[model samples]
Target chain A: MKYYVCLMVVFLFSVQIQAQKVAVFDSYSDLEKAVLSDENTTYVVNFWATWCLPCVKELPYFEQLNSANKNLKVVLISLDFKNQYETKLLPFLKENNIKSEVVLLTDKDYNTWLSVVDKDWSGSIPATLVISKRKKKFVEKMFSDYEELNQYVNSIIN
Target chain B: MKKISVLLLFVAFIVTAAFTSIAPTPYKIGDVATDFKLKSVDGKMYSMSYYKKAKGFIVVFTCNHCPFAKKYEDRINDLAKNYKSQGYILLAINPNDPEVEPDDSYELMQQRAKEKGFVFPYLLDEGQKIYPQYGATKTPHVFLLDKNRVVKYIGAIDDNVDSAAEVKVKYLENAIAALENGKNPSPEMTKAIGCSIKSKK
Candidate 1:
């Protein structure tokens, strides 16, 4: 009976370790439902990859932005391979102490989803799309500092 | 004797200062090669029209910041060294927004050219207006133009970004070879991977 309890504890711990803190969505409908269900809320979706340097650099700024603005919903979508979810995604979130909802995008066709997100996006990482009630702005460029990001966010929010 | 030495030192400083301030003239491929009067690092003004009698030119958009651009720097030097004598002059252009990316500035461009031992002319595109005209989205984007200044090829240096052996297609080299041999290049356009050309607002 004691041995069974130990096994269960270890299994639960391992399961918790594998699950990432960020919410990942595999389908557009689910993502839309999560964001659109809240009418007054603004959603900031940042598409990033672990391998991309600019994406990694701008992550802290996004975290700061999310913490400061409680009313805004910030979603960090990791474009990392689905197979490497446990190996790459989970550890990155835990290590960074990322508080924002994180999710792994499972779509294989990049161009299709890229166009879906915003037609102006050139399929680049570190890309951000600000979705408000009836306005949307997409920036497909990399930001070197927090001020640059804040400027864009402020423009949309205001 | 002390006064004479001071005067000599001042003259040397003035000469060095003048040399450092010199910037190369910028130009885009597919456009008619303009007669640029910009000064070289050696304090000599070079004109593209002087080389108009040549077979063609290879215009490369590259910078110091991007790792992808750095990877092809040595290869670019080798290509320039090899082909410049064959009537093909390699003109490098730095089109990144200077305010945002200081490495693409005129002084840094000169410093990079000196450090890389670049034999080709590295020009600074100040406002970044010329990059988009040529449709250069990425660094190390090559534009191979014929004698008539028509764009013959636009794309990556090759298919392999990591290793030369893995390259299935040598786009720039193949285009140059075709131009030299009086043949139309096969697959004249291809997608290149590198940092986007930073544009000025």
Candidate 2:
């Protein structure tokens, strides 16, 4: 009876850990609406991909920021090719147990919307956009650690 | 008190200098490109002057490892194959520091070229000087130049990176067409999306 109870407990814990639901958006307008829907919360939108090493390395920092802060909304937008949704991205999230809100941005019209994200952006991965109703900060580089990521969150929130 | 003030001033100067040492400006459209002598994977040293009869050059800053660069490798070869006979030589330069990315080392570059059957020159930016001069921020960044070495266009090969078939706009090809017709290329610059070029710490 005790062994059965232990197995059930382990199964429940695994289920909780593997719970990552990803939303897909085909256009920038839909993404913009979702991000701007909340005026009180600052959305920390991170552009990344499964193939980018720096992006994968910094995923935990975003996950920590997501759980610790209440007013900050964290969105991990995957730039992985649309075809890889089933084969690569889903398996990566499941295997790594990424809990943060994930989304697949299927927009192919990059030149039209890259400037909309930031005037200084050169369309590089591991870029970040911290946005609220009153202010916005765009960083076109990787956040080295949790401290640096926390600093960005604090700067935008306060 | 006077010594303390001097010390504070020295500290302020050091901080200011540290923050203000910005990188130099990169070449823009219409700017004359500086010729570089880089060693090719085929074991030949080449400069812009080597292509004596060429009408223009397709200068691409790409490497072997980046998945995005790998995606465009075949297309790059196609460009070289189609244009080499037309006097536009393709010169691919790998700028990633080998110390930072071992996979982008000179040997691998040679191996990739051999596997891909590349007829163009795949060169290594030895001291990592050429990319900064061109202001390339990522792999697969392209700079199209005319015969006089004036930059005609600087950006991506096309709008769609995921699939070659789904592409609606061919930016580089259009720019090359403009140059062929003796006109300034429309939309000379576009954002290139790819992996950041790894630099040594």
Which ranges in model 1 have alpha carbons more than 4 Å from their true place?
A1-158, B1-47
Q: Write the per-residue lDDT of candidate 1 for residues B106-152, one digit (tens) a residue.
A: 77777888998999888776556566666566677788887677778
Going through the candidates in order, their DockQ values are: 0.07, 0.71
**Candidate 2 runs further than 4 Å off:** A1-17, B1-11, B18-20
> Whose lDDT is greatest here?
2
RMSD per candidate (Å) reads 14.1, 3.7
For candidate 1, the TM-score is 0.57
Candidate 1 local lDDT, A2-114, one digit each (tens):
99998898667645744635556776557667654576778888887665556788899897888677868788887765656779877787777676777777654432455
| Highest TM-score against the true fold, candidate | 2
TM-score of chain A of each: 0.80, 0.85
Clashing pairs in 1: A22-A102, A23-A102, A23-A103, A24-A103, A24-A104
How well is each residue in B62-132 modelled by candidate 2, as lDDT tens digits? 99989999999989999999999889999999999988889999999999999999988999999988898
TM-score of chain B of each: 0.77, 0.91
Worst 10 residues of 1 chain B by lDDT: B26-35
